[model samples]
Target chain A: MTIATATMTSKQRMLAALDGRLPDRLPVTTHHLMPYFLDKYMNGITDQAFFDYFDMDAYVWTVPHRHDPSQGEYPDPEQGEIGFLESRRVSTDDWRVYWEKLPGYEYQTVRYRFVTPKGTLSMVIQSNEHTAWVAEYLIKNKRDIDLLGEYMTAPKCDVEAVNRTAEEFGERGLVRGHICCFDVFGQPGCWQDAACLMKVEDLIYATYDDPEWVHELLKILQRRKMIYIQSLQGARFDIHELGGGSASSTVISPKIFEKFVAPYDKELIAAAHHAGQRITYHTCGGMMPLLELIADMGPDAMETFTPPGMGADVNLAEAKRRIGDRVCMIGGFDQFHYLIDCAPEDTRAEVRRCFEEAGANGRYILSPSDHFFDADPELIRAFADEARRCSYR
Target chain B: MTDLEDLRQSIIEGDMKSTTSLVESALADGLEPGTILNDGMIAAMTEVGRRFEEGEYFVPEMLIAARAMQAGLKILKPKLVDSGTKPLGTVAIGTVKGDLHDIGKSLVAMMLEGAGFEIMDLGVDVPPEKFVEAIRGGAQVIAMSALLTTTMPNMRATVEAVKQAGLRDQSVIVIGGAPVTQAYANEIGADAYAPDASAAVRVTRSLIS
Candidate 1:
């Protein structure tokens, strides 16, 4: 461990860690600032204010999508100010949306209907205060997939909008975005995206019942993502997120991952590198089995290394030993247990433990395994203050 | 291979078409319906569970195998009914209210059904009243699932509802999901906690037996 003579900015510290070099101190950050947590715990503070309050490294997320008017693509009429975390909606005339309120449910149910000349497809989504989930899947019938391949609008990167935000958010934190996925419910990985469209269980059954159709659906999704990647050529993003919790070992098998997750993501990562962007494979669950395989994808970083206590099998020290040389590792702290309803000193101890195990190699960022809807504000303060004390000297 | 052995092999391979056809042929040969179910579908699912525990199989494999077993069961159901065969136990399962995530709950329901337990799926965002209603409807076990920590309190509420309705001794309460743990189960006074779908089967069996 080497001590630094001068302090570094939050951006400088994070960039150094991403580059596999030591910074002035260990870089500490949280996975996501959930809106529920902000309202309930932080008195509705802005994400930047929360970061400033904790004195930790911050991150800004933005996804600017461009629509092609020649294809009849237009901005969604119902899109609100905070549209899926700074993402703009673009859809074709054939794509229509409808909403309904159930008699007993707390959330509003939405239907995104895609009408094609061949056929029509629709997906049902339910949204509450925190986030939304798929109520009825998009690809209800086998033929609906054909409708999607034909009529779904392909959204491009709004390079000018992204550049404007990048300029406005200069040096405040890292600029992060994700590779395009299917609208409403999707994953960056091809098979995972298909699993979202078609139910995961049915897609898995189809792997044996109709393997060719499975491959074809994946190819269709992969092509759309490729077009999205092509438009990312001049975007000034520090790190672009790929992968999702669906690709985690806790959800699928290593055999499935090798056959489905790796092939598509590997190519996407290569293309992202060619576009002068960094990639982080975000797996919010068990990753012990696929560590080497994910590293082989050649992403600059891997995240949400959920610890064992949080229903995952991550052994942070062992993970650091195995693949720490290949890519920067993020997340391992058990926020569910230590971040609330525990002693502040205990929270500090867990932070120290994570730093001792994963932070030894200078390329580790201490973060919660994943998002947390509820937390003790004081413990969050302790988490950051303790991390500040974990200086490498 | 014997017809039963072929049936088991087909199911393990997740060959739904072959498994269903084999079940039809075995019935045509006058094999006992109970024997076919025990020696064929159940035996194959046991192997699938073992392979899943050993890491050779995953959710997709388990789902395919479960579908194959369902296909075979579809053929064996009428015969089993004619012979007065009964399921081992009855379990009512649902995702607790305020949590709409159903993949985990669905998997557990399927696994329990595959393990020979009769399942009454109440679907997602099910309230405590639903659990009580299922218990009143002669469910032997109440299995509740919640994927979010925010919704976990509903598990305790369901447990309280059962006790309040004077049905605690008649029904065993089991809870599980991504954020659920044995400690949380204990804290909430649940009878048992299962970490995964396979474990849910074993735990429910133990509670009933």
Candidate 2:
């Protein structure tokens, strides 16, 4: 076993591991910025601090869009600040965003109003942790689906902009680019995309009434994503994420997954690998049932391994025993109670348990099964500190 | 043909046509509505819940079974209404403020209704006051669902509001979602937490019982 200090760059270590090569030590990483931590203590620190403070591998997100300002509609807010960054509520079309500052919390609430054909919906958020999710959108009915089919514009790719971001991130850490979902209402492809464009309740009705129309809508979203993947030609992303757990084996029956999900992602993942990129399956729910199925879909890594006690039956030992060699296992820590205000001893013990279960194999990285909100500082320190104690021989 | 054995067989086979037809035939045959409900529909739902928990069934299966149960209820409800068949309890449910996800909430409501609890679905973006009103309207349980960590505090506030209304003891508080856990449930002063829809049925039954 090598006892190493922080000498190798984060990118070198992460890439080495991804290539099935050994690094100096295990690459400790995190999935997201903890909203509670940043708002309360950090006082609005930079996004870079998420990796810097923890001394973990950095995951840089690059979103490249080539928007035609003329074709794109911009709202000039009547009340608050007005800029591309600033927003206001439009009564008619529902796509609106505005920010408000609270007294104690460092972040501001960004409220978004989405006006869809079925009804109007709104979401208020104070942090990225709770970034407003949309419930309804303009594409609610069958005719609205037809409208999106006819008029929805393809997002032009800004390859140079994305490559510039990647160049900057490559010097410090790993640069990861993601596909922008159409709207926050649903999946970027397949059943979830259909659910989001149309309401879930309404979609259920549609599935029975007009199965063929639903199939056409899924095909359109799937095709758009295929075109986007083709655009990712020279972007230097280590891994691109695809497929939400809502389509995982746990959320839907194998029938629905095979019927709607597999047919779509199989094409995409094959396309991505063909384009020389690895895929990460982000299943934030029970994955035990779908582990084999997900592995079959060919994601390079699986994340958010919800512990058995926490709804999803994630037996880390069994997971590693089953599919650890096939792909990297991204998360296993029981963040629900163990990370928040828990005993330091308990936190340390939990970390060791994950290590014993998953770390023995070569493809495990420690992370919270999912993101957590506010947590005790001592527990946070304990997690980082205990993870460092696990050595790779 | 409208007997409990026949109805149970139809449901087990997922013969929605036969199940719907049986309910109509039972009503036409002057069979007791309560018997068709407690003996037939609820029994099928119970079997569905058990199979779901045991992993013998999945979401689509549960959804289809819930659809069949609702169909049976459509036939049985009016007859039960005339015969004065009362529900086991009432539950007020919604996805809390700031969270737009509803698949989890919708599944829980279906499972609760399948268990014979009348559901007062307050829809999504439900503020604290809406929960208070639902409780005041004779809901025995106040259930909050949130898919994000940001909206979790809304669950706590709803629980506190019910307490402020002096209805906390009279009403049991429950919360569930992709991000929710038992520890969060306790920290937020909720009486119970169910990770999934099947467990939700069991948890609600345990709470009200």
**Candidate achieving the largest TM-score:** 1
Against the native chain B, what TM-score does each candidate's chain B reach? 0.96, 0.95
lDDT of each: 0.84, 0.71
Global CA lDDT computed for model 2 = 0.71
Backbone clashes under 3 angstroms, per model: 0, 4
Best by lDDT: 1
Q: What tens-digit string does per-residue lDDT give for candidate 2 at B1-209?
A: 55787887676555677889999998888889998888888888889888888888877677767777777887788888899999989999999976667878888898788789999999877889999999889999988898876678899989888889888889988899877888889888899998888889889999898
* Model 1 score (lDDT): 0.84
lDDT of 2 by residue, A1-393 (tens): 223565567787666666655655566676666555677756766558856765666777665555445655333243354322121212223233333443553444444444444544444444344453442344545655554554443454567877787787775667765544553334444566665555555555555556687678877787767866776777677877676646654557666666667777778888878877777777777777778887888878777788865557789999988988888887898886677757999998998898889876457778888666666656767777777767654
User: TM-score for each prediction?
Assistant: 0.95, 0.84
The best candidate in terms of DockQ = 1
Give the lowest summed-lDDT range of ten residues in model 2 chain A. A83-92
Query: Counting only residues 3 or more apart in sequence or on different chains, how many pairs clash (N, Cα, C under 3 Å) in candidate 2?
Result: 4
